[model samples]
Target: MDLEKRPREGSETWVDPRERPAGPAVRREPDAPEGCLAVAIRIPVRIVVLVLVVPVRMLWDALVVAGRFLNDTLLRPLGRALLWLGRAVFVWPFVGLWRYVVVPLGKALGWLGHVLLVVPLVWLYRYVLTPVGHAIAWAARGVGAGAGWIARGVGAALGWVYAWLLTPVGHAVMWVLKGIGAGLAALGIGVWTAVAWLARYLVVVPALWLYTWVLAPLGRAVAWCCKGLVWLLSTIVTGIGTALYWIARILFVLPALALWRWILTPAGRVLAVVGREVWDALGHAWRVAGHISLALGRLLGTLLRWIFVEPVRWVYRSVLTPVGHVVRDAVLRPAAEAARSVRRTTRQALAAARESVRQARADFRRMLFGEPRQPQPVDRREPSGREPRTLGSSTTALTKD
Candidate 1:
């Protein structure tokens, strides 16, 4: 839908902005016409580039396929295995130690510190120190009030003396000093006026007359002489410049221009056309070579699949698979069952004997100690990864609650 309103159908002056094309309205300049030389150059250059690029494109494609095969078959698996080994060797042990040992120890130390130091400090701050600080603050407030009162009394006395005794004496001194200052300022002003008048007549008047009368006419004459000299020098330089310009044109510039206009320009245009043709041919050849290489690679992959992969796959499916299944059912299953039976029997017998020994020890302990006391359980810490964990599962006691 067009959000902008359309131009009125009757209005010849109005054009709808939405009706205009998305791009700029300006037309593209047409390509210049190619001469016979460029046309002639393009075909041969493309043929040569195509011939040269085909083999290289095929080689590059082969290297790419080989590198991919090697990475998938060998390098990728080796890198994954190394990464797993590094994690197992370097990372997992530290994680286990931190989880199993350090975490527990840290929790125990934190609890001990809280009980031993933090509790006492908190008690002292809440009881003894808080009361002492409050008492001291209260005493300091009282002392401050007394000091403020004393300060106010002293300030009042000082203000009274300043108002009554010092004010009149300062006023008398200021009046006398004002008279003396006025007399001194008048004397200085008269001396300054006399000096200014004498200096004006002695130095300033003479300098003004010299500049206005004698020096002014002399400077005008000098300036006129300088102007004439500059004009003469400029005319001589201009003549030399004109002569040099002609000499340079005859000796170098005209010949250079002639060489450029008659020889180099035409040659450069020809070379430019040839270079453009070569560059275009290279790009075209490269694209064509890419298509050829892709086709060749597909053909080669199809041939390899028929010759190697299909035969091996067929052999594995038709020949080995049935035989392996038969062996697993007939031979391996019975062997595994027998092993499991033996293991179960051994474990059961061992467990029964251990139970007997434990019962005899318990009987002896009861007989000797008259029923041993059971120990109490401590607070359970957070469970580690020894237990199986499921996704989205939490082991925290609060979560269970």
Candidate 2:
């Protein structure tokens, strides 16, 4: 806002909904001041809206609490258990098979193929094929050199024959041909010169004379006649256009403009006033309705707590709690102790069986594969990819992580 629009120091700066804009003709205008119609609309609308919205808001709050409680107490743990079970039953077995069985078998097969096929192929390529290729290349080079020598000798003989014997004969023949060509060329030039002179006099001269004298004057006269016709037609079109423009203005444009300025404009202003009042009333009613709904929601919540929650809480704490404690101490504790004892004895028996099974498996494995090797620690200066960093570790750029 500009300085003129800003409120002055020490002035009451708060806006009043009832306040109208500062202007000379503000009273004459329809949409500025709030009217009796707005008050008539606002009061009933707010009351009706408050009544409708209170029940909805209360139900909405109840549903929100119920949903949160269900998600936390029932749905959340069930989802987690399902996720774990799915991984164990469907996903883990495939992952283990790929990692242990398929990967190792593939590696062994690849190693076997390399040893049996690739190694011999490499040996043949390096030892047998390489020597044979070198021998062929050496023979090819010898052949190429002999052929080149023979070609050079043949070329020298051909050059000598051309220079000593054929050169003189060719020169004599060329000299005779040049004399005959000179005579024919002189004769052709004379014939061509006579034909050109005849064509200039018979065709070109007459055509030029006809164009300069006859065609140019005729074209200019035709052009003048065309220009006169175009000028007369344009003048007639301009006069008709001017007459039509004035006729349309008087018949259509002037009356329509007068109707809008004198009639429709006033009616539209009145409609704007009614519409603005309705809009402002709706806005004020909505805000008032919100406050009323909030108050009603609080009142209903208080009533519900007194009627339902308080009674349930009282029953759980004052009645059910004592009964639960008595049952737990009198009968449940003794039963739990006996069950725990039985579980302990069964666990001991299962542990012994598991020990025997583990020993037997270990003996079988040792007999077949011998004792497992322990990994030796190595000194390193750089960190491994994706491993957590520590005080002793430093990373290198070659690590993708």
Candidate 3:
């Protein structure tokens, strides 16, 4: 299909468009030409609105004026009366209480608190606590000084003893060791000289004669063999050491140098050359992934809107919300009213029961106890010329009566 020439109502040649009824043309007035008299004579929108709304505006202004007059005449006086009454009834007493009672009481309390608590605390801190702390500190300082003096004296005594006795003892011991060592050395030299003379005359002369007569040639042959063996082993050891030295140099040291020179240097250069490219590629990939993620999120949001949100919103608006309103009005409202009535009835019953219980208690008390007697007033006057009655005379008179 050719989208540009698509048909709206018909399929033939894809050229048909929808036909609809047309209403009569209603034209707007063209704007007045610039610098013309019509442009200069244009009425303001506010003026037009004012002309249209004059009666309503006048009515509103008259109402406002009447309201203001009424407020000023009646409400203002009433409000002032109420304010005056409030001041007289509530504010005056409060002010009096605060000024006369509360202020004086607060001042007294503050003075008492300062005198009883704060002043005592200050005195204690100043006199007792400070003196105690200073005394403790002085005692500690004196004890520390005494301890340090005693330690110094003890150390000096120990140093003196070391210098006087221990030094001489150590020197004497060292001298004794040197003398003993000299004596031992001299004895060892004499013993060695005697041993050498004895061996040379008694043993060496005979050994030399025997070697000259019988063993000299054999000894020379054995010596020659030993020299040859020693020379061969030395050569072998030297050759092995030289070989090992060259092998270690070629394998470990030379390869390390070559690796540093060739592989590590070139690898560093290559890494430097390609590091930026790799970083850029990674950054570009990250941005592309981020864009894809955002696009996916938007697409998912659109799909969710279309599939779930719109349907849920439609159902709520069309069905659930109206149902909820109906339920609230029909069921919940009546239930709330019934609950309030029940609560009121329950309160009335409870009050009636409480009254009945109180009446019953009062009746029970009246039944259990007879009427209580009222107390008589006492007469305290004494006769003019009579002495006060004694306790025995009063008791006898009461008995006679």
Q: Which one is best on TM-score?
A: 1
Better of 1 and 2 by TM-score: 1
Would you give me the overall lDDT of model 3?
0.75
Q: Runs in model 3 with CA error above 4 Å?
A: 1-259, 372-401
lDDT (Cα, 0-100) at 189 in candidate 2: 100
Measured by lDDT, the strongest candidate is: 1
Report lDDT per candidate: 0.87, 0.81, 0.75
Candidate 2 C-alpha lDDT tens digits along 167-270: 99999999999999999999999999999999999999999999999999999999999999999999999999999999999999999999999999978976
Q: Write the per-residue lDDT of candidate 1 for residues 142-236, one digit (tens) a residue.
A: 99999999999999999999999999999999999999999999999999999999999999999999999999999999999999999999999
Global local distance difference test of model 2: 0.81
Task: Write the residue-wise lDDT of candidate 3 on 294-339 in tens digits.
Answer: 5665887799999999999999999999999999999999999999
Per-structure clash totals for the candidates: 0, 0, 0
TM-score of 1: 0.68
- Residue 52, candidate 2: alpha-carbon lDDT: 59
Off by over 4 Å in 1: 1-33, 101-117, 189-193, 287-306, 325-401
Root-mean-square deviation of every model: 14.6, 14.3, 30.8
